[model samples]
Target: MTKPSNFIWYELMTPDPDGAARFYGAVVGWTIPATRDPAAGDMDYRMIGRSDGGNAGGVLALNADMIAGGARPVWLGYLEVADVDAAVAAIAADGGAVQMPAFDLPVGRIAMVTDPQGAPFYIMAPVPPEGGGESDAFSVTEPQRVRWNELATSAPDAAIAFYKKHFGWGQDGEMPMGELGAYRFIQRGDVGLGAVMPLMDGYPAPVWSYYIGVYDIDRAHAAVRANGGTVTNEPMEIPGGEFAMNAIDPQGAPVGFVGPRTS
Candidate 1:
C-alpha cells in the first residue's frame, strides 16, 4: 500500500540566499547557518534550521543557469510516498508533468513535478534514519514550524481531485467564501493539514503558500516590514480565531505567518 504523504520537507529556492536567511531569521525565528550542504556538491544548498533544533527545510541558491532559465524565488514542498518511480509514473499518466527526473539522494529519491494545474512541488520516498520519527517540518502550533499549507489554484475542483487520487488526501469540509469559492479543507487521516482555496485576481497562477507558526502575528508583520518584505494584507482572523497574514519576502517569495495578534 502506498503510504499517504505527509509533507516531509520544504525548500526555498531564492536568488539572494544570505538575504533570505536574514529575512526569515528575523520574521520566523529560524536559525539558518552560513554553511552550505556538502552533499549537494558545488550547489549552494543550506539547511533551514528551526530555533528549537532540527530543520524547517532547506534554501537553495539559484545559479546563473537556473535564473536565466526562468527560475524565480519560490517555496516548494516535498510529499513522501512509498515508491517514487511508481508515483511519478502515476502522476504523469494523470496529466502531470515531470519538472525534474527522479534521482537518488542521501535522504531518498526525489522528483520535481507539477500538478495538472501547473503548481510545482516535490515527491519523495524518504529514507528515514535508523530510528528517526515522522517529519517535524509540519506542525499546527509550534512556533517557527510550518503550520499550514494552503494551495490557491485556478481550478479548485480539478486540483483537489488530482491531489486526492495521487496522495490519498481527503476533502473533509469547506467554508463558503461568498462570491469567490468555498475554502475546501483537506486532511491526511485525522490530522487536519490545511485548506485549498480558489485562485483570485491577486494570485493569477496556482501556488502553495506555507504559513509558519509565529509567536505573535503583529510582531511577525512588523519584522517583515523591517526586513524589506511586503505584507499583502493586514492580519485577518482564521477559523480558529488566530490571526493570519501573507507577505512577499525581499526576493518576492510569497510567505505567510499565523498566530495570535498582540498589539
Candidate 2:
C-alpha cells in the first residue's frame, strides 16, 4: 500500500463559490486568494490560506448548470496514487465506480470516483514523492494535528475491499461504536490513513469526510463558530483518549478535527 504521509489538500466544489469563500475565510482565518481558468468558462478557484501564507486548501464554483447535467456539490478527498489509470481499473474491478475518468492536471493526473456504496473521493498521481508546493500552516492555528480521516459508509466492508485493491490499504481491529458493531481502521504503515464505518442513522448518502489537525478542542470550536461554521458535535473524548468535534462549514460540508485529550 502507498504510504499517505498527510492529506495535502481539501477542496469544496460548491454552488456559490464566493459565499463559500467568505464563509471559510471567517471560519478558518484563511484568505481566499483568487485563481481562475478562463478556458473552463473562466472557472474560479479560491485558495484557502491564513494571512501568514499557509494554504489550507481550495474552493471551486460548482457550476450549477453543470449540475443540471449531473454533478453534485461535495467534499472530495484526493489521495495520492502511484498510477492513476491502474487505480481506476482496480477500483472498477473492486466494486467502485468512476465518475470522472482520469484526467491530467498541471501537477498530475486525477480522477473522481466512489466506493461500492457511493463514498466519493479523488485520486492523484503525486507530482513528487512528498507532495509539492506548500504545507498548510493552518495546523499551527489549531491545537490538534490533522490526525485521522473517517469515512462512514453503508457498505464498510466493500469500502475496505475496494481501497485494499486500489491503494493497498490493510485493516486493523475495529473500534466498536455501541450498537453499531465495529468501525475498522485502514493503514498503510504506522500512520492511520483513515477509517471506514457505517453511516449514521439518517444522513445524506455516503461521502468522504476529512479530519483536520487541531491542538485544542475548545479553541478550534470557538474559531469554527467565529468563522460562521457550526459545531455539529461538541468537543468530546473518544475511547482512545483523543478529543474530536464534528463541524459543518458555512457551505454545509461535513468536516471534523481531532487533538490529543487535554486532560
Candidate 3:
C-alpha cells in the first residue's frame, strides 16, 4: 500500500484536453498516451508519460455539463490516504467542505474536498498498479516530475493546521517575505514537500499551485511561449541554484516550473 500523506497523483481538468496534452507535451517533453478504462465509461483519459517511461499524471476532459456547472480548467493534486471515508469525516469535522463524495474508480477510492479556506484538493486511497511498485509521477528528485506543491490561502495558519491534522505534515522551516508574511515550508516526515503563504491580492480564490521539474528552464520557457502559453514571471534563481517561474497554460491553468537552466 502507498504511504499515507504522500502526494500520489496530479491531474489536469481542462476544457480542451487534447490541446493541453499537446501544450504540456511540448513544454515538458511528456508523452500523452491514451488510456481506455472500462470503469470510467465513455470518458477519455490520457496518461502523461515521463522520459523514463513512467506515467506522470493524467488529463481529463471537462464535459459540457461540468462546465455549465461552473467547473473551470485547473490542475488538481491528490494526496494519498489510508481510508477515504474516515479521512472525509475528519476533514468535515475540521471545518472543510466535501466537493465530491468518496467514490470508487479503477485507480482508487477518491473524494474531492476543500479546506476551510476553500483551496481544493483530492484525498484518495489508491489501488496498487498491476506489477506493484510506487509511481514516480509526483517525486521531489525525479526529472520532469512534480517537484513542489505551493498553497496560496487566505488562512495560512488554519490551512497548515488542517493539513497537519489530516496528513501528518510538519513545519520544516520558513522564509520571511516582507509585508507578505512568511513562506512556511511543509514536510511529510523529513522530506520537504511544499510551502504555504498568504494569498496575494487580485487572486480569484485560494488555490494550490504545483511546480514541475524541467532540465532546462530556458528551453521550457521558450516551449511554453511557443505553445500559446504565457510566462507570467521570468525565470529567477531560487535558494538552491535552481531557477523557477510561474506561467499559465494555453487553457489558462496556472503552473510553475523549476530546475537548472542550461542557458
The estimated TM-scores of all candidates read 0.97, 0.82, 0.95
lDDT string for model 2 (1-263, tens) is: 44543455677787777666676554444566555544334667666665555656667777768779776665666777778898888888777899899988665798988878888878777566365553442232242223566888887887777777666677887888898867888876555667888888656788777777655567678878877788898888876677778898777677787776453
Descending-TM-score candidate ranking: 1, 3, 2
Q: Which structure is stronger by lDDT: 1 or 3?
A: 1
Residue lDDT tens for model 3, 173-247: 899999999999999888889899999985778999999998899999999999999998899998888899999
lDDT per residue for candidate 1 within 150-231, as digits (tens), equals: 9999889999999989999989999999999899999988888899999988986899999989999988999999999999
Q: Which stretches of candidate 3 lie over 4 Å from their true place?
A: 1-4, 34-39
TM-score of predicted structure 3: 0.95
What are the runs in model 2 whose C-alpha is more than 4 Å off?
1-7, 34-41, 50-54, 129-146, 239-242, 260-263
Each candidate: RMSD: 1.1, 3.7, 1.8
Number of the top-ranking candidate, with TM-score as the measure: 1
Best by lDDT: 1
Give every collision pair in model 3: none
Global Cα lDDT for candidate 1: 0.90
